[model samples]
Target: MKKIFILSALAFSLAAVAQNQKQAMTKPKTTPNKAVVYQVFTRLFGNQNTTNKPWGTIEENGVGKFNDFTDLALKEIKDLGVTHIWYTGVPHHALVRDYTKFGISNDDPEVVKGRAGSPYAVKDYYNVNPDLAVDPAKRLEEFEALIARTHKAGLKVLIDIVPNHIARKYEGKTNPAGVRDFGADDDTSVEYKRDNNFYYIPGIPFQVPTSDTYKPLNGEKNPLIDGQFSENPAKWTGNGSRLARPDINDWYETVKINYGVRPDGSKDFPQLPEGFAAKEVKAHFEFWKDKDVPNSWVKFRDIALYWIEKGVDGFRYDMAEMVPYEFWSYMNSAIKAKNPNAFLMAEVYNPKEYRNYIHLGKMDYLYDKVETYDKLKEVIQGKTMPDPISDIQNGLADIEHHMLHFLDNHDEQRLASPEFAGTPEKGKPLMVVSATISTSPTMIYFGQEVGEPGKEDAGFGTHSRTSIFDYIGVPHHQRWMNGGKFDGGQLSQSEKDLRDFYKRLLNFTVSSPAVPSKFVDLQKVNREHMSYDAGLYSFARWSDKQKMIVVANFSWLKDSFFELRIPAELIAQWKLRDGNYVLHENLYGRRHALLKVVGGQGTATISIKPSESFVFTLAD
Candidate 1:
């Protein structure tokens, strides 16, 4: 088995080299306004607690309110060159906290994940999470004001829409008039109904799993901390598990939201017609206009439209692959018809369905985690070669502009966590590769810039992913928050320096037209040139008027100087002949290099320190 794995890796490496060589010979197309998304966990962004109790409650560890995104905070994020702010955990979800006094529903502690809740297990689609507002009754108003403030700061807003599932106790209290709640008109007797919102297990009652390693609210005293949850007939788990009494690890708090897919894995609703992939949003909407689709499909579409009407510029769909593509086609088409430029991004892990989701579903972007991010993570961890970057780009060349790139999000661990890279500085090269390699959107989690290690064991979530399931404060991010000032007054020198580096890099990408220009990988052609290893990657990005070369060293232990030989193809593309060209490096100030083109090629002595990245502009 080991031998086979090694041989397969070797074959892939060879193929990647060939692919890069072929790609270098061709030219890349430039895009416009490459989006930079700043994703923040709304509940934790403004909290300032050092005592990270494992299973902390709302009173024990206070949560951040929607009002916390002050004008100064929004301006700072905008100044970082962020075009969109993904406000995570905004929608009301099932939680252990009681808000019954505010006319809100109380989630059963046995079913909820932690003191807070899993943001994916949305309890209500039309209302904001009460915990996020200064007053629980004014949650929706607070969120609307936040959206207006974000737009005022010259940034767009995005919130999550989990189309595949909803909380076990689903309700739509704040839903607009004439809207029917989920399961209100379902036929409970039949196991398979086209209009049913959830699949039922017939006569089984849902039982909470008993685990020695886990407890509701960490054994804290609560009146509703019972071991039983009421479901007349247990439904399937979020991951599609059919067990009535799901295991402790199953997503028991949520039930799958059916979209006309029957129990036998066949589509009950009309599948998208042939060649629908090449159609526009209007065409998609027209096709579904007269078709008889399931109720769940229309419900989700109305839910999305409600938010759009409430001033949300876009939506980030959770586990989008789990839902049928036909539903997305209908829903996204309606969304686009309402707002043509609304950014619709989804979490799709399968590479096979990339084109289908983007073209047929009318989605603007999809997560590039499977190909780009996973490969980059391996490179950052020193387990693989970085030469495959060009391979990834070429593999998804047709849809490259639609692949969203990121190093950290709510699902992923912090870049500086022990489980990932032990130092935040390791992210320098990775971030450069992520931001500059493709014309797709780039995203950074809120605390990622300041090196939040996410070491807090906040209730249901362990060390790694910052907890959305618990009411806990992020320590490193709190220092940057500095008691609601949103300044780095308490940050260390190193931390401040890291943040400054991020600021410069982020702002430069948003302002430079070169970022959206054609990209050329130079490392493949210069492998044998002066100590260049797999840890050092280089590329060139250029438009008709703006052009720049970037080199990033992923190695943390060694610094080396090398002669970066610009390929003849790139030299010809730039129309350089034999005269000397002056080049100025961004990180190294006024230090310039004289590149003399001979035989349609140019060379420069590039001195890159360990974990350093440089951007060189041609000064003519």
Candidate 2:
């Protein structure tokens, strides 16, 4: 009897060991902390001036300086759960402000967008914007100091890289020892050259675009605003307008950079290999390690490396799809070689090219505008139900992690704008969905938390979208700034509560285990069996040690009460047996629901207020 007992004990121990090994093999890999990006229009974040005058100069409507980003401001931003801060409009661009005394030439008002210029129309890749510096002569030093301060605050930095175009009067006064300005050595006699920096119309001179209602400086009298700027051997417009006299709608303020793609749409550089899309970033780097590329490609590559050396953490490429994919493969590979974990994001709108940009172009993230943002906007406006979101997620399952989600940015209308959802409260549930839906990074514009409506009709930009072209104070954001205290001192009670919700949601999102874990669509099953409303969306996320059920109500007028169900397949995957489990709300921690699992399936009675969301975790 003793021998039989010993054999049985030995068999039980061996079985337990085998099962442990199997479970370990099947467990999901731990993912890194999710990145939460806060994109601040650098010039607008710290400005306290409330005088939003139309066609205002920097003195009339104050501009935020690099020195204005005090340590307190950065700490406040970091405490809001932001891992990265994208300081937009940091590079030297053509502005009406005079810096000619500092050896920088005056930009003709006819060629500049506003009193403060469009940040995308870069005038110098080697210098910082003089308008953003307290001392224009020490602009670069001031920017470097800001970068150091930002890092000391434990936050990463991101800046823009507009590769496809540049300000028409391109000038780089502070190029490195061996670097030269773009088009310095180009042969302007031909329209297309394998090594030329720009495409030219040899016999023609560029003409300023004519408009009936628009004028430089809004017709304010200035010597340089004579509607005639000189450009011999006319170059193609930034938007690919081939005419010497482009239409008023054309991107007339900028010139297109040549990447060896001729006007006939033929590539002059080496094409990527057939299976290169599936290869790793290192392999792409190796492919371009010694190969010769176009002059424009080398210039942009050098520019990126230069910024990286300045302690800039990453770049947000503007109009990345307009540039060739092959160049991105080369450029991004070089960036990664310098900093292995550099955050590379881009603005690629075409859904068809999303995979190509992410895989072949080696981009870390692409804007999820056309698919996710557009659909969510419709749901927010009551134009459609939330049922299509699951289909969109399913379609991009393979590359979902590469998609970056945002509701507002420099380009999009503000959430509180009259044209959009029209209220800050409507964004609560939408933000919850945008942040918790996947492992992708979540981004919030500077004033999004306190609900800044882009309603100021600042010159050159009307309502619905905040002005990127003029000097204007963000009223709602300035209230939170509270005269540079960064303490939200002047915010109303409702605004303060909204910001608190954002802080809680963002902090929880970055650290939650279920955010980057396995996600299962619970919408279909609930709709079929539990009579779930179309105005609500549901999903489940879990790991070996954590289980979460996320339900969001998109309805603005009606609260929802329903029996949220979990299918047998998910319960089996979760390794749960017949039992009663308590699920505690993770966001507010004020609510708890009892989940009963019988016959391998589970059901929970859930009641969510209108425009509210709940993230319920299995209680220990």
Candidate 3:
């Protein structure tokens, strides 16, 4: 009787395993929708005041509030085809604004960047910036409402997580139960400890940075602007400056966080396993689930989890490369364990560490600034040909999906600035290439669509890049704001045209099947033709359902008429026989071309105007 029961149980277990295998094999594979991230400086998005005052106070140049992002405003942004809204500078940072009555401590002007303060120098991780709220005490509640409103508008929320550093006067006023501020229990007598929150220079007093031409508030008088800060033992500056008195160029407003890495640059924490890079995020999480970690690591991990719990869809990690990858494996894995679909992007510039960060660190994306953005800038400025772009894309082919492409961001100069392309029209072709060339996410700054040149010298930040450190209004974006109407009622004809083009292009990019499909470079083959010049670039993207041929003219002063050829290999890949095919311009549907296919190869006469591009699709 026992043997018969054992046989029956074995048979039942085998049948269950077979059923599970069949279900797994028959599960439909779904492709992920590409993300279109709209990064807006939260403090500057809705300010309609056009007082272009240098070194202006908040009253002189109005400040945008959380309430400014009304339902109408969010709907307009969503209609622009944005999937995620990265609300930059949401965290409480060191600023000159006084909210002493609300029980918030004052930040010394000597350690603050501007009247509005640098968003990167975070003062409190547990709370939102008081300046963004209608009531100083209700800041967190207002921010939570914004998150809810963003979700109701069919968009995700993204905020900054500055893991590498924090403001020199780090304080968390709204800590959770039993939570403590960073460096609260550190032994300051030693320079390095495995669990110490910061690296210290024992017995050295902190000295404020000195600059001949620059001042904290442009020589404005304030009680805390005396160029004296109180720190008995100076900590290392955010930019890794070891001196007690950091240089003018150093990030003196913030102090670095130590994550188990000693002064000799060796990690005291546990390293990831040899094969962990290829492992899943859950596996990485399991690896660190029971292991002991440094106090700084746990603090950062808790901070990220806290934000995730607060309905933030993701984070944009600042200077992620400065922090160790193992900490990311721990922190990000913890985050993924909570929300598997969280969007994790980092600002890592080194090309060599791209794969490590993406795979081992479990980052969803990294900025493609150094290679793609810089090369595109060179091409737009007439400094280099677009030929190297194909190489750059191919070099990072294994990790292309992890690279986020953008023509403009807060750190880079605006596309319309004189230092950049000098006009918003020049960004048309570059935008096409940056958006459609890869399977990665695409980002655009707040004022990019309507062409804010960021030419104001607002306080500490100069022209070309929008000021994140001062109270100022974006003029061109304000035109679209139209005094809180959230409509483009006051936009000029040219500005309207530009915004229209962006809407069409971005909407098509997000919904097109061919965008995330396989790409074939046409620039290499087209280089042999006489009409195909360095100023022109072409490519093909095709899948089982859709096929597209993209061509762009980067020249600002020339038009191009070329015999765009499709090699026999690509024709065969598209399953085309010897016949004629009609290619319709999908951008505007205004132009169509006839492609003659003979002996499996295809050729068409294509004409493109300067700073114009087209995504030609095969007609049904």
Candidate 4:
């Protein structure tokens, strides 16, 4: 009997110790910092104007008045608790082309016919258009001030940089090399086109692919000049004039840089589109002109570095895949080496290749295309909820290493379109999908949470019905993307509710990602409707020693009672006889007589309702 008594006493001691440990776990939390981010295209945010309208309709218009960039910043953004702001195409000079050769209407997509070209078709990277940058002289100060104000508001800034190519037509120089013509007439002769070996490709995209099209002007023998229309085959009396637009070469393509080959087989760097074509430039050796420099590319690295030093944290490298992966790695390291917290995001429109950017820490974030696309489809298409667990999980794995998580930004389809909204009733559920589930970092495009105002789709010649700019009387919206003015339609009360819903979720995500997992374990509460994405999810979090119970439910449907194993020791101490319950930290640690019943392992059952979720922190 004495020996039995001793054993019983020892058992009680261990239970008491376990209870103490459970209580001790609640030390306190400094709160986890959230990486939730927001992005936008500033020109599209404000008043519409006609003077800047390159298109006939508001949906196609994108140019905003230069001075409006600073005016659009409202108080709502800071209160939203986002850490980052991404602006699209700030410095793109308008190069609306006159494309009459295509035999399409000036208003047609084929004929640019003087419309605002995509900022990606930049004429110069250095200068901001006076129209966009109202006072060119004070532009830099204004930009700096904007950055300062953003930082003061507790947000970082991200600007887009298109490194692939520049606009040829908008530039003052008729030559593809962008050299000043200097009072030169439209002379298309051997002497006029090629001087000191300098020549540029013609307006035509693809006709002749060789330097053999080049011949020295006045028969001079310098390696510096090449000209467009080289295909004209100077004095090819051997045959008739082919009339093919000659493709002359230029120093920009041949000049080498700090990096290795220019990808175009010339010393010149940062030229031409990347990928398959760059490799093909190798087959025709005679087509390439050599200046006898071993191998060097343009000093684009220095330019990016200079930008980093000038108060920017990092860059969202446009077309990262077009550039060599090694260089991307080096650039990421370079920028971060300067500012440890710097983020270098990549722009990739593809969905399946999303994982590639995370390979070398080369990019802090590339939009999570799959998650956004799939979830949007599921919600908007009346299809069952998508089982995007794998996709979302893959995204989070990268975020563990500081990867950027997101929904929509400047490029591609807007998230607010029909692609994400099914019926007005499902809008809130869609918002939940966007803000929660996979637990990765999140981003929303500008005006996304607010609703997309109508604008004309210049590329497709259709109009987006969102016309908040028109409704709000934005002067800049009238100047640009809206072709001076527009109204996609009225904002529905449901849509407004959806926006508020997103704000709530955004605020929650920022706080929840920081939760300390004690006994919490997420489990599939039900697979019945889970495949259809119409089920509740239950997570079991327990403080074994605390002997408290926490039960939570997740779903966008009407239901009650989650099926879970209830631990007896935890149950004995507390009665979990109900549909839904939450376990606070204090309850998980406090001593109570009922806690005695919950020392043994078992399962607990809980319940949930539509669009509702729960969390339980069990204690002794």
Q: lDDT per prediction?
A: 0.83, 0.87, 0.88, 0.41
List, residue by residue over 1-620, the lDDT tens digit for candidate 2: 00111112222244444343343222223433789999999988888888999989888999999998999999999989899999999999989977889999999988888789999999999998998898999999999999999999999999999999999998999999989888889899999898888899998999999889998999999988776889988999998999899888888889999999989999999988899999999999999988889999999999999999999999999999999999999999999999998999999999999999999999999999999999989998999988889888889889988999999999999987878877888877889888888889999999999998899988996788889999999998999999989999999988898888888788877777778777789888888854577789988877666688889988879877778899999999888788666665666655556667899999987777778887877622
Report the lDDT tens digits of candidate 4 across residue range 236-314. Answer: 1111122233233221111111233222434332322333223321221222223231121123444466556657666
Candidate 4's TM-score reads: 0.59
Regions of candidate 2 where Cα sits further than 4 Å from its true position: 1-32, 529-531
Better of 1 and 4 by TM-score: 1
The lDDT, on a scale of 0 to 1, for candidate 1 is 0.83
- The alpha-carbon lDDT assigned to residue 339 of candidate 3 equals 97
lDDT by residue (tens digit), candidate 1, 494-541: 888888878767766775667777878887888866578668988888
Clash list (residue pairs), candidate 1: none
TM-score of each: 0.93, 0.94, 0.94, 0.59
Error of 1 at 174 (Å): 1.7
* Clash number for candidate 2: 0
Looking at candidate 4, the ten consecutive residues that score lowest on lDDT are 1-10
